[model samples]
Target: MSSSVGPGDGSANRDAEFTETLKSVAGMANLTQSRQVIREIGSSVIQCAHDRTVSIIVARQVLDGLAGKLRSSGSDDTAEADAVVDIADYLLREINAQGQSSNLVDQTVGLCEVAATAFETKEEYTEAAQRLASIPLDESRRRVSPEDKVRVWIRIVRDYLEVDDSTAAEPYLNKAKGAIFDVNDAELNLHFKLSQARINDAKREFLAASASYHDISFSPKLAEEERLHTLTMAVRCAVLAPAGPSRARALGRLYKDERSVMLANDFSILEKMFLNRLLQPKEIKEFAETLQPHQLATTADGSTVLERAVIEHNLLGVSLVYNNIPIASLANLLGLSNDEAKTEAVAARMIEQGRLVGRIDQLKGMVWFEGGEASGQNGSGKTAAPVDKELRYWGANVQSLAEEVERVTAELQKQFPGFVEANLVV
Candidate 1:
């Protein structure tokens, strides 16, 4: 009484379906329609041969025909979209089962790439990443060029980033990093750098993320709007960075950037933070609205990252305006509660960490500001001290320092091999 046919009967019907499909495709007047119909075959009836190898050979020919042939037009055709994904997945399982065939592998790459694009368009990023990851990077089977591999891995990183999966994205990003230099395409390299920035941002390495975003903002290859958008992102990351000499220097670079002026909302906060001006609750609230969910994430201190950054930044701001302030009073000024001990602890930590450039007088319940117009961590009137801020690092995971070191080494290796080899490790 079951409606489902037995396996043998179903196989016969599928085989018949495949035979008729090819005939219908051969007689078709429109090449695009023929291709679209074929696009659905692997998902539906490509298994008609019953032999996995034979089916792959047939499916590969159809996919190869799809190569160099564009879709010609967009469609909301959900059925066609679903079929495209199914085709890729079918190839995926067969590829795993069968040993690598050079011809099949080559065509599989193209079809999988197309399927990945379809997934991305539908905003199914995890599926897109998996589709891209399934591509065979084994050079023994086929030629896998550096740029080609970088393109795929970077695309995977971008997909994982889209879904807020940094852990998943990191390995693919590292894969791309190894091949990025060999890629001559500026756009691809730009995206590689952007992906790194995105991961750092997700990981709360704001200083590092800001530096990359700031550098990218100056790329001449970017359109004006795109450049400005990156500039905006740079400012946000910089503002969210920890209050210290390194962060101060990073903020200075963005503040000095001419393009930063184009983004009024971002520029306003940038100016205030760079000048060490106290931020109001209203202003902070408005600026907070512009940040991404990750940017607004909570820290171990039970405060949003934005809240922590602002409080610490305001502490530095107040330090510049006053020679000394009581701990209770400092708490109120920093928008914290009437908790003098907690306020004093924050000051003490910043001073110990060389961020506040001050001395906390616990007995007197006062923080003696060391920077001026009050005194001068050189936390003073605008412009940071003309020192080599590039070498400064916060701690173990300061990603910016490593990146900056690499840039300098790459430049130095161009002309000074001895210095690079002796002092720097690539």
Candidate 2:
């Protein structure tokens, strides 16, 4: 009653049925259905390969078919996109185990790009960048040109920065630099320069960053908005730079630029006011009020720029007039509160940095400028009456000691003439 179909016949029938099912799945208009088909194919491939020792050629066909379905599914659907990545992972393993293919490297790279795009869409920027970097650039069969290699390297730099890892970006940037040689592309060069500037800024080398921004701003090929933005950044860097003539020069250049007028802020005005020799403490205070919290240096008391400026100004003002003043009076002149703690904090900074040469006496409530006449006198600020008894006794003791030293030297010379000539202690 039973008719036997041979083992080979049953296997052939199953394979033909699978091929037909794959074709039908490929033709389905619904993306969700298409993903289900790919998943089914994956399951069948694994099952058949284990039970019947499916040939590598058949496995390759199934993989290629799955990739085709994935391409048709598009990237917008999360389920379909993840399925594509899963299939790519399987294909990669198969290709690695079964030996290389002429087209496999390209296919692998394509899959990695897809995976990276998916990760990027999810805001997993670090993983996305890593996926792109895993491409086999050194493969002899890789068809990517020198320029494309540089592009890849540049992307790595950007990715590293997205995660705020400049230390990691640096090696990749160097690789990009090496790859860019002999590549005569202006746009790529600009991007490289911009990335370099950003890296410098992230590293807190504002002066170097300003120089880079200045260079990029002058490029005729850049857009007007971008050029102006770069110039504004350069101005900020110049302002933030340690006070020096170069900072003055940078600010001067920014002030003279017509483009700077377009920036709607007090940055330029602040820079100008800070540089003027005749600028008063009141003007500095007025300008300081306009800056945002981030623009000023912070202390335990408050965010203050004018505090430091007024302190320096008062020190200079007093240096020009009265070099000797009580600490309380100095505090009052600098517009500081009567609190000696606040006064000492401000004055100590200037004196410690050698910007002011002075000494403070907290107990006596006095400050003595190095060159002031009061410095040579006692704290009463009056010269002592001439030669007290105690002072004369000290002077006599010093004179007697000097006379005894001279007599001892003469006696030594008389006793040992050659010894004195050869080994005289000066």
For each of the candidates, the C-alpha root-mean-square deviation to the true structure, in angstroms, is 16.2, 14.4
Model 1 alpha-carbon miss at residue 363, Å: 2.7
- Candidate 2 weakest ten by summed lDDT: 373-382
Off by over 4 Å in 1: 1-59, 66-76, 94-103, 372-426
lDDT by residue (190-247, candidate 1, tens digit) is 9999999999999999999999998898899899898888889989999999887888
Q: Give lDDT per model, in order.
A: 0.73, 0.63
Error of 1 at 99 (Å): 5.4
lDDT of 2 by residue, 122-147 (tens): 56678777878888888886667778
Candidate 2: give the clashing pairs.
none
User: What lDDT is obtained when candidate 2 is compared to the true structure?
Assistant: 0.63
**Among these predicted structures, which one has the highest lDDT?**
1
- Clash count (model 2, backbone only): 0
Off by more than 4 A, model 2: 1-33, 39-90, 93-103, 219-222, 273-426
